[model samples]
Target: MSEQLMVVGEITAPHGVKGWVRVRPETDLDQLAGIKRCRLFWPDNKERLFEVEQVRPHRQIWLLKLKDVSSRDEAEALRGALWMIRRDEAPPLPEGHYYVPDLVGLEVVTVQGESVGEVSEVLFGPANDVFVVRRSGLPDTLIPAVREVVKEIALNQGKIIIDPLPGLLD
Candidate 1:
C-alpha cells in the first residue's frame, strides 16, 4: 500500500449561484451523504482536505457544498477537481478487486518468468479494465483484465503475474 488516495468523485461544474458544485461520484449514491470530508486534488498538483458542508442529490448527479467555499465563483474554481478520500475512509472492496492506485506501480511479469514492465496506469472500461504496462523502450502494453489473461495479482508481493493470451503481447 503506497499511501494511495481513493478517488471518490469529481467536481464537474458550479451549481446555481451558491458555492455548491455538481459532483459525479464514483461511490454508491445512497452512501454519498455519509461522506463528510475528502481530499481535493487540483490540476496544478496541489492537494488539500475539505470538510463537506452539505451534499444532496441533484437529478443524476449530486450537489456538494464544502466548508469555506461560499460563492459560485469559488465553486467554479474547483471545477474539474478530483475528489478523493483516504483509503481508510473508502468502503471495503470485494475479494479479487483492487483500487487503481494499488495496481499502478506494481511490477508486471508473465507467468513464464518473462519481464514485461511496470503498471503505469489503468484504463477502465464498461466490461473490464486494461492495465497499461510501461516498458523500457517498447510501447506500453495493454493487458486486459480477464481471468484467462491476468493469472494472479499479488499486491502483498508488489507484482502482478499474467498469463498472456496468444499474440496478446506481440
Candidate 2:
C-alpha cells in the first residue's frame, strides 16, 4: 500500500446474511465508528474503495456494513481484506503516545551509547508494552516499556534509548 495509507482493520468473516462483515479493528471503537471511507486491500494487491455504511461493536469484534457489499457471499469474498485509511485521516494521538506502527523497527541503544539491537516486536502486556530487541548471535532481549526503562524515543533519528536494569544486557 502507499505510505499515505495505514491499515486500520481487517475483514475476518461474514457477519449476518446481510452485507455486514466481522472486522478485527486496530483502531478504537470511537475512531472506527467515525470512519466514512475505507480502502479494502484484496488478493494480488488489488484494492477497492468502500463507503462505510455502518459500524457496530459485536463482542470482541466489529460488524461493518460497507456500500456495495450487500450480500453474505460478497462479504465472504472480502475475508482477509485489509481496511485502510489515509494516515492524515487518523485522529491525533495524545502527547507521549506513539502508534505501534511508528515504533516498530527502531534501533535500540543504551544510555551510554551501547548498541543493543533493533526492535523486532512490541508485545502488549497487561501492565505495559514490552520491546523485543533482536541482537546478533543472541536471544531476543525483552525490555519493559516503562518510563524508567525506556528513557527516550527519538523517532526522527530512528532510535530508542533505554536505561536498562542491572544485568539486563548480560
TM-score of each: 0.72, 0.77
Q: Which 10 consecutive residues of model 2 have the lowest summed lDDT?
A: 25-34
Worst 10 residues of 1 by lDDT: 25-34
lDDT of 2 by residue, 51-75 (tens): 9899888877788999998999998
Candidate 2: regions farther than 4 A off: 25-34, 53-60, 167-170
**Residue ranges of candidate 1 with Cα displaced over 4 Å:** 1-10, 15-35, 43-48, 52-74
Report the C-alpha displacement of residue 71, candidate 1, in angstroms.
6.8
CA lDDT scores, all candidates in order: 0.85, 0.85
What are the RMSDs of all candidates, in order?
Answer: 4.1, 3.0
Taking the tens digit of each residue's C-alpha lDDT, what string does model 1 give over 72-122?
Answer: 999898998999988777656668877777888999999988899999988
